[model samples]
Structures are given as structure tokens and as C-alpha cells.
Target: MKIGIEGQRLFRKNKHGMDFVTLELIHGLQQIDRRNEYVIFIQPDSDICIEEIANFKIQAFSSLAYPAWEQWALPRIAAKERVDILHCTSNTAPIWSSIPQILTLHDVIFLEKPQTTGSSKNWYQRFGNQYRKAIVPTVAQRCQMIITVSNYEREQILKTLPLPQGKLKVVYNGVSRRFKQIQNKRELINIKEKYRLPKKFILFLGNTDLKKNLKGVLLAYSIFVENSETVIQLVIVDLKQKYLSEVLKELNLPGLQEHIVLPGYIPNRDLPAVYNLSDLFLYPSLRESFGLPVLEAMACGVPVIASNTSSMPEVAGDAALLVDPKDALLLANDIGAMLSHNNLRQRMIRKGFRQAERFSWQNTAEQVLQIYENTSKSRVTRMAA
Candidate 1:
């Protein structure tokens, strides 16, 4: 089968969750399936991480904008390449494409009401949300199959979009092997020195997104600091200092900034080390389809404290402490408890390792490949009939 995978942002440096998911999916497919021909369509950029192999080929397309690229360029290329299936890895896909398109609609968060208005998110985020909100429903209708990461997201999609019963598929996201516990003292020290990390800290991977609940995390950390006898720093990755300052002022926790460490964007390769160094990991998002970071942290042998809402409990699955994201006091108390109790922390770490072992890219890839094969066979059978 000739498969065209939409990996528009794959080649870019500093990838986010969706980009890593797509990248890992491609790598998994590459390792498992050599008979099936694959074409990975991506917007031209510098990262060039994936190399062309025997069955897998990298195809780059240059376009002025994301919508134009997906709408105009991607479909034309896929048709020209005569791909049997075009899998849009991201949430949005080409609406006009006649190809048997498969869309990985990560979540329908964009379609929901704005969690925060005004400057919570920048112009780029606002525009992207609006674009997805407009296009996802139409694209979801046209696509051959809609793949969501978690069961919670599957229900959300079912409720939000009017679709046939079997049109949607649920495939769990996998944690990469890179996120294993770091044993080497030298490597940990290098990463620590590289980021100038604190001696001890709680890690919260967040951005300016309102759903990330950065404000709540900051407030909770403030509460944790105020209540606890020992002061442990909070390390937040990929957040801008200027934005952090603004948020600090807004929360009236200007003193909180000193207690917080912003090491900016840590590369994906180095994340495992950061996870190892962290005393505890926080994933208190308001909502998530699949909390990849939760698993990633767990894989690195860190006890996690995640929000109880949405798919978090589904993903966490008793391996991590779950608390309501909205309740800053509760979150802070949990953080304190998790830190103070050695036995509880050790139990969580052990459970986390077991939980992380359950999900793997190979399994995810196999499931996806099965879907592709089924779709192809069904198409051929229809034609024969």
C-alpha cells in the first residue's frame, strides 16, 4: 500500500506534542512495515530529522500558509503521487481532497468555549483555533476515518460532531523510549548544567495556552511554597520570561517568580533527563485528549500529579495522583503531600513504570497499519463488487 502521511510540521525545530506524535508514528511505521510504501508530506524546514529509506520517502512542499498548504498543496501532491491513503496526522486535513483521507483529530478543544479570553493566548493561537473550529467539522465529515488519541476524546468528538457509528477510531498515544529513567550521573549533570536547573524542583510543562492552566499551576505552586516548610523550586519549560512576568503580576504573585525557574524550551531529546531531575511532575491541564507528558514523566520514574478532569484520569490510571485542575488549593495540597511522603512517592513511581510500559509506539503503529489495510481492502472489495 502506498500511504501518504501529512506531517506538515515534522521538519521544524522545537516540536510540540502533535509534531512528536507524528514523528514517532512515522518512525514506528518505518521500523515495523517495510513492504508498504510510505510518503511523508511535510512543509520545507531545517530540522530534516527523518531520512528517506527504501519503503519510506520524505516529500517536502512549500506553501505560503498552513491552510493553503493543507487545502491546495498537500492534496495535489498526494494525487500526483497516486497514494492509496492520505493520513493527516494533525487535527485538520484537506477538505477538497478526493483521496481516502484519514484524520488524527487529536481533540475538539478548539470547538469548545474559550477557557480564557483576550491576552491569554497570542494572535497565532487565536487564529489557529478559529481555523480548526471552522474546518475540523467539514474535514471530519469527509475523511474516511477519524482517529482520536483517547476514549475521552472519542466521546467528545461523538458529542460535538454528527458522524456514523464506526467512523471514529480510538488509538492511544505512546511514550517514546527516549523518556526512560536516566541512570547516568554525568548525563543528568550535563542536562542540569545546560538548563541551570535548580537543585530540587517540581516540573510543569506548560505554555501560554489557556487550557494548559498555566495560571492555576502558578497559583498552586505559590500555595505549595507558602504552606510547605521546605522550599522546592518550580521549573516550567517553554514559557517566555516576559509572559511569565506578566502572569506573575496578574496573579499578584510577583514573589512567585523568584521561586519559579523558566528554562525556556527544552529539546525533546533532553526531556527525559529533565524528567529524571525533577522531584515531581505536574500536568494539571483543564482538559487533554491524551496527556503524553504525564506518561513521559512516568516513564522517567517521576511521580506525577495531574488534573482529575477529562482523559487525565484515563491516562494516569492510578499511577499518578489526580486532582481537580480548577482547585489551586487542592492541587497545592496534593503537591505537598506527594513531596512529603516518601512511601507514597515510591509507590507512585513503581506504578508509573508499570503504567508507562503498557503503551508503546510499535503497538500504536500496528493498530494504525491494521486500519490502513482494512480501509484499502474495503475499497478494493467495493470496486470488485
Candidate 2:
């Protein structure tokens, strides 16, 4: 069967969760399945990460606009290639594809009721969310199969949308093997110098998304520092100083300005070192379908302090200290205990490794491949009938 995979942002340099998941799926498929013909559809990208292998081919298709690129150009190309099954890896997919489609609806958070307070999203993010809101329902209803990252997200989708039973499946995301503990002291020092990281710091991968709960983290950090004498810094990745200033101002924690470190954007290759060098990893997001960073930190042998809400508890599984995302005092207490208790930290580290081992890209790919085969066969049976 000819399988067409929509990997729109896979070739981008700094890939996020969905992009990394799609890329890893493709890589895993390449390693496992060589007989089936595969065509990867993508927009124009400077990075060009994926290479052509035996049964896999990369095709670049572009349009002037993002929506048109997916809705118009993508369907046209997939139909032209006569792909047996088109798997849209990202949350959104073409609404009018002639071929059988499998959409990976990562989350339906956009469909939730808008918060009373204004959103923290910038113009681009707002536009994307609007587009998803407009298109996801129609496309989801029309698609042959729906793939969600976690059971939590699957339940959310079913609750919000009118979909038939057995239509949606949960395939958990996996962490790469590269995210292990880095023991080389010299290499660690070089990475620390490169990012200007403090000797001992807590890591929080922050962003502009409201659900990331950056302000909550900052407030929690402030509380932790106020109660403790140790001068531990908070290293934030992927957030700008201007945004940090705004968050600090809103939290009324001007004193935390000196204790925060902003390393703009760290590449995926350097993340393992960052994880290893940190005392603890904080992922206190308000909601997530599957929190990848929690697993990544665990794989790196770092103790994690994550939110107890959403899929975090499901993912962390007692491997990390879980606290309420909104409760700053509770998060601060957990952080203090994690930092001070040596035996607890050691136990968490060992459990984290075991938790990380439960997930693998190979297993994810195998499950997806089975879905492809099943969908293809079912389509054929329908056509015959």
C-alpha cells in the first residue's frame, strides 16, 4: 500500500511536540517497514531533515498561505500520488481529501469554552487557533480514523465532538534515546558556558502559551526561594526577557528578576545536557494531552516537579513530584522538598528511568502501522461490498 504522511513542519529547525512526534514516527517506520511505499508531504523548509530511503520519498509542496497549503495543495498532491492512506500527523487535516485519511488530533483544547480573561496568544497563535476551531470539527467528522496522543485527549475529543465508537485511538508519544544523562564534566561545562547557565538551577521550558503556566511557575519559584536560604536560579528556555518582565510584573515579584535565567532557544541536540545539568525539571502546565518534557527529564536522570492535572499524573506515574499547577504554595513546597531531601530525590531518579523505559518510538510506530493496514483493508472491503 502507498502511504502518504503529512509532515508539514518536520523539516523546521526548532520543532515542537507535534513536529517531533511526526518526525520520530517517520524515522521509526523507516527502521521497521521497508516494503511499503511511503511518500512524505511537507511545505518548503530550509532544514530538510528527513532523507530518502528505500521505500520512502519526500515531496515538497507549497502555497502562498498556510491554510491553502494544507486544504488545497495537500489534497491535490495526495490525490495525484494515489496514496492508499493519507495520515495527517498534525492536528489539522484537509477537509476534502478523496483518499482515506487518518488524522492525529493531538488535542481539542481550542474547542473548549474561551476563558473570561483575554488569551495570552499572539496574533499568529490566535489565527492558528481560529483556523483549527473552524476546520477541525468538519475534518474530524469526515476523516476515516482519529488518532490522539493520550487517553485524556481522546476522552476530551469524544466529549466535545459527535464521533462514533471505536473511531478514535490513543497512541502515546515517545522520547528519543538521546535524552539521557550526560556524564562528561567538560562537555557539561561547555554547554553551561554556552547558555550562561548557573552552577545549580531549576529548569522550566517556558513559552507564551497561557496553558504553560509560566506566571504560576515564577510565583512558585519566588515562594520557594523566599522560604529557602539556598540561592538556586530558575533557568527558563524559549521565552524572551520582555515576556518574562510582563509575567514578573503581573505576579508582583520584582525580586525574582535576578534569580531568573533566559536562554532564548536551545536546540534539541543540546537539551540532554541541559536536562542533566539541572537539579530539577518543572513542567507545571495547566493542561496537556501528553507531557513529553516530563518523560525527557526522567530519561535524563533528573528529578521532575510536574503538575498533577490533565495527563501529567498519567505520564509521570509517581516518578516525579506532582503538585497543583495553580497552587503556587503547594508547588513551592514540593520544590523545596525535592531540593532538600536526598533520599527522595534518589528514589525519584530511579523511578523516572523505569517510567521512561515504558515508552518507545518503535512501539508507537508499530501500532500506527497496524492502524494503517487495518484502515486500508477496511476501505478495500467497503469498496468491494
Candidate 3:
């Protein structure tokens, strides 16, 4: 079977959740399957991370616009290659493609209420969300199968879209093998000095997205610092300084800036060390399809504090302290307790390691391969009939 995967943003230098998911899926497939022919479709990027394997090929297409690239260039190329099934790893797919499509709809956050209006989101975010809002439903209706990361996200998709029950599949995302406890003392020290990390700190992988609950985290951290006697700091990764300044001003906690560390973007290879160096991982997102960082942190043997809402509880399970994301005082108290109590922290660490062990990229890829095969067979059957 010739399986085509739309990995548009896979080669970008600074990848996000969906990009990493797609890349890992491809890697997993490469490791396990050698019988079927696979083609990865991606936009031209400076970072050439993925290498061509036997039975797998990487095809780069260039376009100034994302929609034009996916909608026009993608379909034409897929047809030219005679792809049996095209699996779009990201949220959206080519609407006009005749080949049976398997779409990985990571989340239906765009379809949810309280949608971000003008000025609420930056131009790129606003454009991407709007594009998804416009194209996803139509693509979802037309696609042969829809894949989501978590059961919670599946339910959310069902509530928002009228797709049939049989068409949706829940395939949990996996943490990279690299995210584990780092034992090399010298390497750890080097990474610590490089990032200028605090001696003891809480790690929150923050971004400009509203759903990340950055403002809420800032408020909770302020409350924690004001009440607690500990000298712990909050280390935030991937957040821009300009946005951090705005958030600080909005929360009226400009004085708390000294306690916060913004080390900018840390590469994926260095993340395990960052997790191991941290005292705790805080991921109090208001909404998420699947909180991959929560699992990554847990895999690194770091105790976590995540929100009770959305897919987080499902993902974190009994491993981490689940708190209401909106309740700042509650989150602050939990952070303090986790910091001060040795037994509680140790117990969480043990549970987290066990939980993280449950997910693997190899498993995810095998399940996805089954979907592709089934979809391909069905298409053949339809043509015969």
C-alpha cells in the first residue's frame, strides 16, 4: 500500500505539539513497518530532521501560503503519486483530495465556545484558527477516518461535529524515549549553566496561547511566593519576553518578575535535562486535547501539578496532583505542599514513572498502520463493487 502522510510543518526548527506528534509517528512507523511504501509530504524547511528510510520517502513542496500548499499543491501531488490513503497528521486536510483521507484532528478547540476575536490572538494564530474553523468540518465530513489524541478530545469532537461514531479513532500520543531521568552530573550541570536555571524551580512550558492559562499560572505563582517562605522560582520555557511583560502588567504582579525565569525556546533534545533539573512541573492548561508535556515531565521522573479539567486528568491519571486551573489559591497551596512534603513528592514521582511507561511511539504507530491498511482495503472493496 502507498500511504501518504501530510506532515506540512514537520521540518520546522521550533516544533510544537502536533509537529512532534507527527514526527514521532513517522519515526515509529519507520522502526516497525518495512512492507508498505510511505511518503511524507512536508513544506520546505531549514531543519532537515527526518531522514529517508527504506520503504519511506520524504517529498518537499514549496509554497508561500499554507492553504494554497495544502489545498492545491498537496492534492495534485498525492494524485500524481497515486497514493492509496493520505493521512493528514495535523488538524486540517486537503478538502479536494479524491484519495481516502485519515485526519488526525488533534482537538476541536477552535469549534469550542468563547472563540478568540480580533486583538485577542496574534495574526498568525487568528488566521490558523479561522482557517481550521472554515475547513475542518468540511474535511471531517469528507475524510474516511478521523483520529484524535485522547478520549476526552474524541468526546469534544463528537459534541461539536456530527460525524459518525465508527469513523473516529482515539490514538494516544507518546513521549519520546529521550524524555527520561538524566544521570550525567556533568551534562546536567552544563545544561543548567547554559540555561541559567535557578537552583530550585517549578517548570511550566508556557506559550502565547490563551488555553495555556499563562495568566492564571502567573497569578497562582505570585500567591505561592507571597505566602510561602521558600525561595523557589518559576522557570517558563518557550514564552516570549514581550508577552511575559504584558501578562505581568495585566496581573499587576510586576514585582514578581524577579522570581520568574524565561529561558526562551529550549530544543527537544535538552528538554529531559530541564525536566530533571526542575523541582516540579506545572501544567495547568484550561483546555488540551492531550497534554504531551505532562507525560514527558512524568517520564523524566519529575512530579507534576496539572489541571483537573479536559484531557489532563485522563492523561495524568493518578500520577500527578490535579487541580482546578481557575482556582489560583488552590493551585498555590498545592505547589507549596508538593515543595515542602518529601513523602508526597516521592510517591508522585514513582507513580509518574509508571504512568509514563504505559505510552510508546511504537505502539502508536502500529495502531495507526492498522487504520491505514483497513482504510486502503475498504477503498479497494468500494472500487470493485
lDDT (tens digit, per residue) of candidate 2 on 1-385: 9999999888778888888899999999999998899999998788887999989999897789889999999999998998999999888999888999999999988888776113556788789889999999999999999999888888899998999969999998898999898878999999999999999999999889888988889888999989888879999999999988987888888879999999999988889999999999999998888999999999999999998888888889999898889899999999999999999999999999999999999999999999999999999999999
Cα lDDT, all candidates: 0.92, 0.91, 0.92
Candidate 3 local lDDT, 161-219, one digit each (tens): 99999999999999889999988999999999999998989999988888888988999
* TM-score per model over all chains: 0.98, 0.98, 0.98
Q: List candidate 3 stretches off by more than 4 Å.
A: 115-120
Local accuracy of candidate 1 as per-residue lDDT tens digits, 265-356: 99899999999999999999988899999999999999999989999999999999999889999999999999999999999999999999
Over 4 Å off, model 2: 116-118
Looking at model 2, residue 75 earns an lDDT score of 90
- What TM-score does candidate 3 reach? 0.98
